[model samples]
Target chain A: MLLQINDVNKQYTNNKVTNTVLDHVSVSVKEGEFISILGPSGCGKSTLLSMVAGLVKPTSGTIMLDGQPIQKPGKDRGMVFQQSALFPWLNVEENVMFPFKKEMNKQEALQKAKHYLQMVQLSNYGKHYPHELSGGMQQRVAIARAFTMDPKVLLMDEPFGALDEQTRTRMHGELERIWLDTKKTVLFVTHSISESIKLSERIIVMGTRPGRIIADIPVTLPRPRRFDAPETIQLEKQINHLLKEEIDKVVKEELSYAENR
Target chain B: MQRIGKQLVFFVGLVIAWELIVRAGGWTPDVMPKPTDVWEAMKRGFSDRTLVYDLQASFTRLFIGLVISLALGTALGILLAKSKTADDTLGALILALQSVPSIVWLPLAIMWFGLNEKAVIFIVVLGGTLVMTINMRMGIKNVPPLYIRAAETMGSKGIDQFIRVILPASVPYAVTGMRLAWAFAWRALMAAEILSTGPGLGYTLKYASDFGDMSLVIAVMILIGVIGSIVDLLLFQRVERNVMKRWGLETN
Candidate 1:
């Protein structure tokens, strides 16, 4: 295992009110495996991903990367946020080169930035600022910046959640190509069952109410899974059925609370 | 370009109206000098080196006062932003002091520094530091937490985070603060120069008014306005526009 998250639990406390966000969740990821933690909203899926990134602390258990305990955020794990958190002050090339500060000279960093920007097909936008780019282009610059750091793992939290349907579908293909080329370990979190099925080798289905893993289904089908493929359709339907129950529970809880109020 | 053209037309119209009014009203030079009379006075003062001396003197005091306030106020602002204890104890007191006008500090300034350049500089610094501190606090507070988290994952930590992430993100706010401070310090310098005997535009205005030299007084006032506008256009506004454009803060 390249990364191990064993019996991890997380609780958040505010004003003497304690909420258990995750409960006894355990997961193991291999060096080059692509996994998706698929669930509905409020299932603590994002929280779990944040914990692995070392941005949040788990209440119990441990998360180890490369046999070392994850204590704080480092260059080892890179993250792609849902909203493309590119630094607005830096242009595309400068933003990609930012993490290379003090690690190499300016000329070498520029060269490396050029390489990654080319990888993302954004070499023409080296001098353009973030505001000048479209949403998809900005996200591309963010991906280039993250890959330029050459982290051990890439954690994406619904990286295409904000895009329209057509752009989302196109980005899925682009992301798959990038993953294939890099062959890096990835832990993706998303609410879209079809997206998870198309992208991940294994999908961890989670349930709400003190969130925990309910199923771990493997997609044994070959790469470049087509939307019309029988295996892809079957897995999507199965995961949708598993998740519908959890989503209904949430809806009912909210409805009852609203009625009482 | 359109804005400049309109401004030029309005300015020339105003000057022509002033000249016509002074001539038609039959007002003596002591009451209100004609626009051309004031322009001639300006040329004469510049030739005699009196206007240059006063401008240099006033600008030196303004520059020194600005540097001092910028350093002290920025440090104090960072302290207030970063520390809970300091903000709780001293923040309210600082706000109270700032609420009182900078002119109100004149009596105390005179008592402390006693009718010297120090007195004028002291008041100018007082006028600026409070506004700078307030703006710095707002700037630092407004820096998004997302930027910090992103920088941390890039291997920046502790002081490196503060210097690189926090500081650059707060610059837009700081620039706004500096613009407001410049306006306040300019007014405070004038008030101080008028009260204390000094070789500045304010002092020249006072001396000319006492002698009923209205043309000289009007010329000095116009010079003050011109210099202030030039600094704002060339220095403050240009920097602010560049920063805002780069940061994507500007809308259309």
Candidate 2:
């Protein structure tokens, strides 16, 4: 396994009430595999991804990458957030080169930034400020910034959740192309079942209120799956059905807890 | 061109109103000088080189004091932001000092440094440092955590991360603080010079007031206002606009 999350647990305590966010969760990701974690809101899907990215630590388990236990965030794992999160003070090229501090000379960093900007089809926008760009373009710049670091694993948390349906669909296609071209392992978190089914080779469904993986389904759709394809529509419906059942269970449990309180 | 035209019209209207007020109020020449009288005094002061010397003296002290305050205040701000212990120990002291008027320290400064440039510089530093420190601290604190996280994931750590990521990102705040500090320092220096009787525009104005030469005093006041606006518009404002434009932080 390129990455292994073993018996991970996380808890948050406020005053005297202890809320367990993740419980006895384990997952293994193979090299170059695209995996999606699908769940309802507050299901701790983001928490799990954060642990694997080393942004947060699991309370009682080890996350190992390449046989080494992860302790902190490093250059080996790239992360993309729902918001663009580009530094407003920096132009497109400078924002992309922000992570290239190890380079001895600024020229080298600029050259590297140019290369990545080209890869993202933003070469003409090197001097453009973040506010000048559209939402999709800003997110593209963010994606280019993450990939500039050349990390082995890419962790995305609802990276397209903020966009409208039309933009989101277009971004889904763009992301697929990038994934195929890069062949980097990705662990994506989202609430959209169709998004997960559309992007991932394997989908991990999570249940809420002490979140845990309830279903781990492998997808066998052919390469370059079209959004309007009959097979894609059928698979999306199947995933939607499974998600509805999990969501219903979560809602019922939430109502019972509220009544008890 | 249009903006300049508008500004010119406003200025001409202001001068006309002031001239009319002095004429209509029946005020003695000792109390309020006519606009023409003040202009004549300004030309005379300029020709004698007294105005130039006083202006230069004040400008030099203002620049030096502001520079020192900016450097020290930014360092202190960063330290306070990075360490809870520093904030706990120094935060209250900073607030207390800032609340005190800069003029209140003039007598003590004069006593300590004598009636010299050092006294004025002392006042400038005290006035500038408080605002600089507070503004910079807020700026550093306001930096988004996600950007720091992103930098960390890119293998940036320690001082390297601070310089490359934190410092550059906080430029807008620091620049704004510096601008405010300059204004404070300017006003404080004038007040200090007025009391301390230095070779400055403030001293010159005081001398004119003592002689009941209202025209010279009025000229000096106008000169001070013009110089202040010039420094703000030509120097700080230009830099601020350029930086904010490049940073995508400009509202207009």
- Candidate number achieving the greatest DockQ relative to the actual structure: 1
Tens-place lDDT digits, model 1, residues A1-261? 999999999998999999889999999999998999999888899999988888999999999999999999988999888878788877889999988878899999999999989988899999998989988888888889889889999989899999889888888888889999998899999999889988888899999987999999988888888999987888888898999899888889999999999
In order, the Cα lDDT scores of the candidates are 0.90, 0.88
Q: Give each prediction's DockQ, rounded to 2 decimals.
A: 0.62, 0.57
Clashing pairs in 1: none
TM-score of chain A of 2: 0.94
Task: Compute the lDDT of residue B55 as modeled in candidate 2.
Answer: 88
> What number of clashing residue pairs does each candidate have, in the order they appear?
0, 0
lDDT of 2 by residue, A1-261 (tens): 999999999999999999999989999999999999999988899999888888899889999999999999888898899988888877899899877765548998888889888877899999998989988888889889989888889999899999889989888888898999989899999999789978999999888778888889898898777778898888788777777877888879889999999
Off by over 4 Å in 2: A103-111, A253-261, B1-7
Error of 1 at B220 (Å): 1.8
Candidate 1, superposed: residue stretches over 4 Å from native: none
